[model samples]
Target: MRNLLVFCVLFSFIFFNSCGEPSKKKEENQLEEISENDNQEKSESGVILFFGNSLTAGMGLDPNEAFPAVIQQKIDSLGLPYEVVNAGLSGETTAAGKNRISWVLSQDVSVFVLELGANDGLRGVPLEETRKNLQEIINTVREKNPDTKIILAGMQIPPNMGQEYTSEFRNIFPELAEKNDVHLISFLLEDVAGNPELNQGDGIHPTAEGQKILAKNVWEVLGPVISE
Candidate 1:
């Protein structure tokens, strides 16, 4: 009787363990299928690759209210059809952006907006390094597709960084734009930067209204590209 009870317990344990595999496998398969479906949806719609840091990530605001979202809304309202593929990773530096350039450009991108380098500025990384990373990304994308519309969103360092350093950082954008002959938005947060109402508590990221202004800023530069 003791032997039989031990045998039964062992059998139950083995049976339950074996049975769990199918359930686990089923869940994994379902998740994979869902992911594939989402990818298909994104690909079919059309793609706008947005590579940047927190500003592009829509930090402190809903995804729908982010600059990308605002751009999508404008696209929709104007009957300009395209998908906004937001690849903005908050806290990413230009080096990180450089690392991911190939992968982002590999996609079916109608337009590419490069909004990185802010974190690099904030961290006081070498301006040359920031410029090189951005330049490499721009060059690589152009190599992949010569006609690809590239928008370089410029950023300004805080005044506390000292006028000399800040001036050098500020000049990076126009210098690159002039060299590359690509479209430039000048400053990503032009009208809202110092405005307390347009920015969040951090005074860095934009509020919802600020995002609208930003989207408008980008559109003023990017609108003609898509329109043409």
Candidate 2:
């Protein structure tokens, strides 16, 4: 009779443990699933992406001084529900921007600011190629997020590139904006460009002060879109 009792207790212990093991594993799996969903939800939230070159990168200044960061500050103050992602890379050309656009678009984007082609124009890259690359970049962004609001930052190259080339380069931004039906910032550097106080020693990238102006330029158009 003792042997029978011992067998029954051992069976009960084994059965309970076996049942508990699956329950523990299921709880762990559920927690893991919940974490993944939370991460995905966070990523899908509204994102304002600034994809461009050195000017956008804030080369000579701190990252926080970058126009995109400045824009973020404005967004925060307004209590807007958007995050800014500065994907700027120094010396980035239209072709390079186009090439890496897919990777940038992988994340959810509510607003996309395109600030490219300046380097391409400076390098004397073919106008047709530059236009084509810019167009493709716009197309890819639209394809990735059909509802994303696109803002094109127009840039001007030095006159040394010759009157005709410079004119054509200057015209690209507006042309592309018109074709794509996107908002355009006529001149990104407006009051900042050519001003030694606003630019770095290199006379190219903007200084911290210059970036503030740039941010305002972006915000003028961006604010309306986000408010909507």
Candidate 3:
């Protein structure tokens, strides 16, 4: 009888241990599944890169106050899966932008917004040079990924440089947009450009209010493209 009781106890212990092992293994498998799903979601998120000068950078304002950040807010509201990257640098000419295009293209870009040439125009760079650099940048982006959508932000400098030069500068954007078949943001600073209230004291960078308009302008073009 004592031996029989011992046998029964050993059987119970083995049964419980086997049951517990499967439960623990099931829990670990569930955790691994959750981890894989999280990684898949992150990898699926697309990147929208806004590459340009201080206008894109929001030079004088808080980083979040930049137009790209504002656009991010809009995107979140719409439940979009794309991420916005502000690659704007202060005083970035088309040449500087060309130099860094490769580095910036390191990340997979679903959409590429080009906002350079403003600094170049302001500084009186030759139109041909500006056009060539812009084309090269566009080419680099295409070479990296032909699927990337390109948007050219049209910029206009005051006629401080003769009207002929200013007109040609303005024309360059449309021409590039046409030649490369990229979308164009007619003017990055439409309603805010000459508005004293919208711009900062420098009359160049937009104030917070000005940034709102810029965001609106971009959305006009961006909304349609993304929707497609």
The whole-model lDDT of each prediction reads 0.84, 0.89, 0.91
Of the two candidates 1 and 3, the one with more favorable lDDT, higher being better, is: 3
Better of 1 and 2 by lDDT: 2
TM for candidate 1 is 0.79
The true-versus-predicted C-alpha distance at residue 214 of model 1, in Å, is 0.6
Write candidate 1's Cα lDDT for 111-218 as tens digits: 889898889888889989999999999989988988788888988878777788899999999999999998899999899898999999999989999999999889
Q: Candidate order by lDDT, highest to lowest?
A: 3, 2, 1
Choose the strongest candidate by lDDT: 3
Model 1 global lDDT (CA atoms, 0 to 1): 0.84
Worst 10 residues of 2 by lDDT: 21-30
| Backbone clashes, candidate 2 | 0
Q: Compared with the true structure, what per-residue lDDT tens digits does model 2 show for residues 83-198?
A: 99999999999999998999988887899999998899888999999999999999999898899999999999899889999999999999999988999999998999889999
**Which wins on TM-score, candidate 1 or candidate 3?**
3
TM-score, one value per model: 0.79, 0.82, 0.89
Which runs in model 3 stand beyond 4 Å of their true positions?
1-22
